[model samples]
Target: MELLNDMALFVEVVKAKGFRGASEATGVPNSTLSRRISALEKAIGLRLLHRTTRKVELTEAGQIYFERCKRIVDEARLAHEQLGEMLAQPSGVLRVSLPVDFAVIYMAPLIAEFAERYPGIGFDFDLTPRHVDLVSEPYDIAIRMGEPESSHLIARPLASLVPRLYAAPRYLERSGEPKEPADLEQHECLNILKANTWTLHKASASIQVSTSSRFTINSVGLIRRLATLGMGIMLVPEAIVMDDLAAGRLLRVLDHWHGKPTPVYALTETRLLPAKTQRFIEFLKERLG
Candidate 1:
């Protein structure tokens, strides 16, 4: 419909932050885009944008309208793309957010294989520690290590990583190896932020140890590196330290007991995803599961 077209244009303008940017993105002349938006305002009998010579800002009503219009436009676009997918391989920009360490250590090979299989799909990957807003951001999916906090986003389980405790051979020689979980209190522990405690499980027995670390970090890569440098013992996913373990850079302690398995998820804003996103999630589940 004409109204739906105008709503899609409005959403683009809001996302681009101005008519000129939207014009560049949509390949429409700035004058025509401006005129259509003005006509839309008149039809709705409400101002949507506050425009100046330099920039355009959304009014309160415009913000609400943009949110609703974005979803509708997205659904329409997805429907159109799904029809195309039935005839050929799904093709589109597949934007994903991933944790840096996990992507490099565990997923890089799998992603490369997937890319090879789907040459039509382009990738825009964001490797950062920050939790991205699935609603506000343009990411198609986010591969996260733990469970997502928001209930609004749809989560698909990809894998469960078994975590284990490890220390550099030199560090174990110097500080002595911990025979049990409680013995960790006497050794230097390297921990991720907000993870000062570790719960190790063995059959029916579980031990909770409050770990102390001189250097608390946010990066799993950094923690692994520090553990290799003999700074302290680390509890991390076994997949992350496979190379180190094989090379004798790190030695596993408490081999009979292991930390809780951390679940990995692919998060999306809505369940009704485009074919590109849906296929990508399915591919990950098939390969990683």
Candidate 2:
């Protein structure tokens, strides 16, 4: 690597026609350029330059070396410029995995904003509940709610969303509203999967209330929709239910009590991320952090 660097410096010095000129062009000091070129010639066991008081000229060996080194330097410079272009305006298909309900209910608008911001990037999104194999799959990244199951994958925390109780006005009117955390047991609670216990916090105090419901759902979108239709009360993030709240479909049940915060993570097979993936994660952190 050092030899290649010295070769590039030599090429620069030759192009400038003198050490002083090369120093001005490359931001390297004239003394440093002179020392490096001298070291380079010594390492190659050839006198590369015939230096006079006012100017420098290439030797017969230096002439041939310049031709070869010039091409190498030009190619290396092109590669660096191309990489800089990619960093500035990344262009490619960004394939990603996302949680279905969260993507639809929460990330839809954020994705639209991102798409508008990065016009050069194309998207390939997979919104599903099944775990994606990042190591074997062609995915750039995966956005998941709650904790990541695998320790092998790299997880970057985007946000932690605290869930609150929500229910349609009709359901609340019919079954009556709970004033305390213990009162949740008497009401019909809509659960995600088989989770029957709802742990809620108030100030510094906390309580775990046993819940019962006929509907056991895997999808948050479905559970939210069910809650809106007066099926039962749901514990979910405000961002997921914002539209429903605005439309008066659901209202906060226990105003002061909040469930545990669910962590949102961006999972990757490795920490070395491409420009597209890195930008997407940064955008999410800015908006949802």
Best by TM-score: 2
Candidate 2 TM-score to native: 0.83
User: Candidate 1: where are CA atoms >4 Å away?
Assistant: 1-88
Give me the overall lDDT of model 1: 0.90
Best by lDDT: 2
Residue pairs clashing, model 2:
none
lDDT tens digits, residues 1-289, model 2? 7887888999988888898889988899988988998998898899999999888999999999999988988898899999888676767999989999999889999999999999989999999888899889999999998877857999999999999999999999999999998898988898989999999999999999999998878889899999999989999989899989999999998899999999999999888877888899999999999
RMSD in angstroms, all models? 16.5, 3.8
Instruction: Score residue 160 of candidate 1 by CA lDDT.
Output: 90
- Any idea how many clashes model 1 has? 0
Candidate 1 residue-wise lDDT, 103-138, digit = tens = 988789888998998888999999988989889998
**Clash counts for the predictions, in order:** 0, 0
The positional error of residue 242 in candidate 1, measured at the CA in angstroms, is 1.2
Off by over 4 Å in 2: 1-4, 11-46, 50-75
